[model samples]
Target chain A: MTLFIQQLFDGLALGGVYCLAAIGLTLIFGVLRIPNLAHGTLYMLGAYVTYFFLVTVGVPYVAAIGLAAVVLAVIGVLLERIVFHPLRNAPHTHHMIAAVGAMFFFQAVAQAIWGADFRRMESPISGSVTILGAQISWQRIVIVVTAVIVLGLLTWFIKRSIHGQTIEAIEQDRTGSSLVGISPSRVSMLTFGLAAALATVAAGLVAPINLLAPTMGDALSLKVFAIIILGGLGSLPGAIVGGFTLALAEVMTSTYVSAAAGEGIAFVVIVLVLAIRPTGLFARAVQR
Target chain B: MLTVRGLSAGYDAVDVLHAVDITARAGELTVVLGANGSGKTTMFRTISGIVRPSAGSIDFDGRQLPDLSADSIVKAGLAHCPEGRHLFAKMPVEKNLMLGGYVRRRNRGRVRELLEHVYELFPILHDKRHQPAGTLSGGQQQMAAIGRSLMSDPSLLILDEPSMGLAPLVTAQVLDAVAQINRDGIGVLLAEQNAQTALRIGHHGFVLAEGRVVLSGTASELLDHPDVREAYLGV
Candidate 1:
């Protein structure tokens, strides 16, 4: 029973990371209607930015994470203004191609600057807590707490705030939003910035445990995509459910089944959920 | 007041509206009547700044609006209630209404006042204020759309097909609300395929056929015209 509880706690910690990544993907998809293929690249960029601030600039680890998030948000706004804005009304294929191009461009830039080295980020928090007779790292607790706080704040904003309501309006119908005086372009920029900032937070929290490299986010990106698909394309609650579900399933599979199979569990879950629901587990039946 | 002269618009190569001229006066309901594919909605789209006019000019409240964005046009006091009652489905009815005042950030109190006024106009919206807009009936959604437009406190309110896909009783209810809206001192530009009902409440009416205004006159005059009766009024 203790073993099961330990694994569950571990799963929750990992799920926090997936939730952060999935939130970025889902937010961009919800407001922009474009599946941002470059999202993983932004995640990788966040980790590198944190690394530069902490190791090179000699900033405190926590402050580095905060700065990285702000930097990534600025970068996201720039990308929105320069690349995404002009292509707003363009075909889906065009935007998809641009996202792919951005992904490659950012990855290449990271490789050129960081030299493709697998670097570990030092944990800002040290020590462990005994939870249900299991020793859990403080860093892991921080990750889970951060995810809960960010996701909670996001939920409140979308549910209650005026700008958040405008975002929802734009998501439902862009032209309708415009008719009501919500500028789609400005909302798109804000959504993109928020997505990038979330990605940065995800990276900052998990980089200490996972090695940082240009390709570090590749698997994480695939896992986030799977989570979003399982959750529902644009449903925020679905992303939360899907993220934790995938994390728990992976942990359980690694503990009981083969460790090798644990890596493949997310994809399997995504396929199974899609086969059963098609529109995703939480997706509404109404076609947009 | 709104004025459009020699307006031409199209998607890529095919022109939808060609050199269209229109004028809407203050405190009057002006209905643009046409069948489907006659560029009725397209006209609203152009006026609302959704579609860029290839040539000519749009003058709203003595300001040229050819270069303004849709949001800017709404901020300039012209609000459009688009066809199909495009309320934000997943959002609550009240939130959808709140979005109507997104451009007028300085007048939040006025926005709330407008919300109360719209709720007074359509009591059903107030009852379902917290409900998701998608779950509402078609008539309710139409009311929410109009209510949202009213939230902006627009000087000129434009609506497209306010009677589409509605029962006669529901249509009458929607038209009555629209009539009340016009009576409140706001200019109204309405487009509809339901020519008879639209003209009944409209102060001035224009009959559109094949992307051009075939006739324009007082609502009573157009209602009595033999050609309009035969072609549109189903007399």
Candidate 2:
């Protein structure tokens, strides 16, 4: 029983990172209407940024995460303005192609700067707390707590803030929003910046627990795609719930079934969900 | 006041509006009557800065509107209640209305007043404020769309087919609300396929056919014009 509880606890901590990453990707997809293939690249860069701040500049762990978020936000805005904005009117395929191009370009950049070698950052958080005979690492606990706070703030902002409401408006109707004085371009920029910040923060939180490499984000990007698809594309709550669900599934499969099956679970989920309910688990016909 | 001179605009290569000339005086309801694909929507979109004119200029309350962005145009006091009542269907009706007041959001008290004004104008919307806009009856949705545009406190409100999908009684109710709105001293530019009903309440009217203005006059004169009656009124 304790062993099962330990596995469940581990899944919850890992799920926080997935949830944050999925929310960012979902937000960009919902508002900007871009699939954003390069989303995972932003996560990879975020881990490196966190590493630079923590090891080179010697900033505190939390401060490193904050600085990484700011840096990623700027990069995100630049990416939107320079790459996506020009092709806003092009066909959907054009956007996807551009995103894939961006992903490759960023991966090359990361390889050039950080090299292809894998590096692991030391966690400032050490020690473990025991609960019900299960040991939980302090780093994982910090990650879980940070995810909760950030998710809470994000939900509140989207639900309550005027700016967030504008984002929602744009997501619902682009031309309608513009007629009412919401600049779609401005909102797109803000969404990209926010998405980037979310991705980076998620990456930074997990950096202490995982090895970092230029290729690290490739698998992560695919997993996020699966998550968003499972949750329902452009559905915010879908993405949130989908993220945790995917993480827990993987954790359970790895523990009870085979490790290889756990690694392949995302692809299976994508196929099964698409074949059965392509609109996803949350999407429904518009009310009325 | 709004003025459009030699305005030409369209999608891609196909021009939907051709050198359309129009002038809507401040505080008066100006109606543009047209059949489907007659370019009423394109004209309004050009004025609202959604579709850029291929030629000519637009002047709104003395501001050069051609070069301004869509949001800037709204800030300049022209709110477009687009055809089809494109409210954020999933959001509550009040949220949809509040978004119209987004530019004036900094002035909390003023926004509140605008909200109150819209509620007063469409009490049904106030009662259904918490409901998702898509769930409203067709007439109520139209009311919500008009109320949303009014929230911007636009000096001139451009309404495109508020009666598009409503029942005859509901259409009359919505149009009555529009007339009441115009009496409140805001300028109105309305486009409608229901020509006679629109001209009855309008100060000035223009008839559009195949992307060109075929006729223009005071509402009473247009009502009596043989060409208008023969073509649009089906008399």
| The best candidate in terms of lDDT | 2
In model 2, the Cα lDDT at residue B228 comes to: 91
> Which lDDT tens digits does candidate 2 get at residues B14-86?
8999999999999999999988999999999889988888998898888889889999888888999999878
Q: Please, what are the lDDT tens digits per residue for candidate 1 over residues B1-235? A: 8998988887886888888888999889999988788888888888888888888899998888978888889989999999887788878898888888888768888887898999999999999999999999989999999999999989999999988898989999999999999999989999977788888989998887778888899999999999989988789
DockQ of every predicted complex: 0.83, 0.87
Per-residue lDDT tens digits of candidate 1, residues A1-288?
A: 778988888899899888888987888888888888889999999999999999899899878988999999999988788878899889989998998889889999999999887888778789998888888888988989989999998888877888877777777887888888888888888888888988999899899988999998788889999999998898788889999999999999999898979999998998898789878888842255
Question: Lowest summed lDDT over 10 consecutive residues: which window, candidate 1 chain A?
Answer: A279-288
Residue-level lDDT of model 2, residues A1-288, one tens digit each, is: 888888887788878999899888988888877799999999999999999999999999999999999999999999999999999989989999999999999999999998999998998999999989989899989988999999999999988999988888887888889999999999899999999999999999999989999999998999999999999887888988888989989988999999999989989999999999988898733221
Off by over 4 Å in 1: A285-288
Q: Candidate 2 has which clashing residue pairs, if any?
A: none
State each model's CA lDDT, in order: 0.88, 0.91
The docking quality of candidate 1, as DockQ, is 0.83
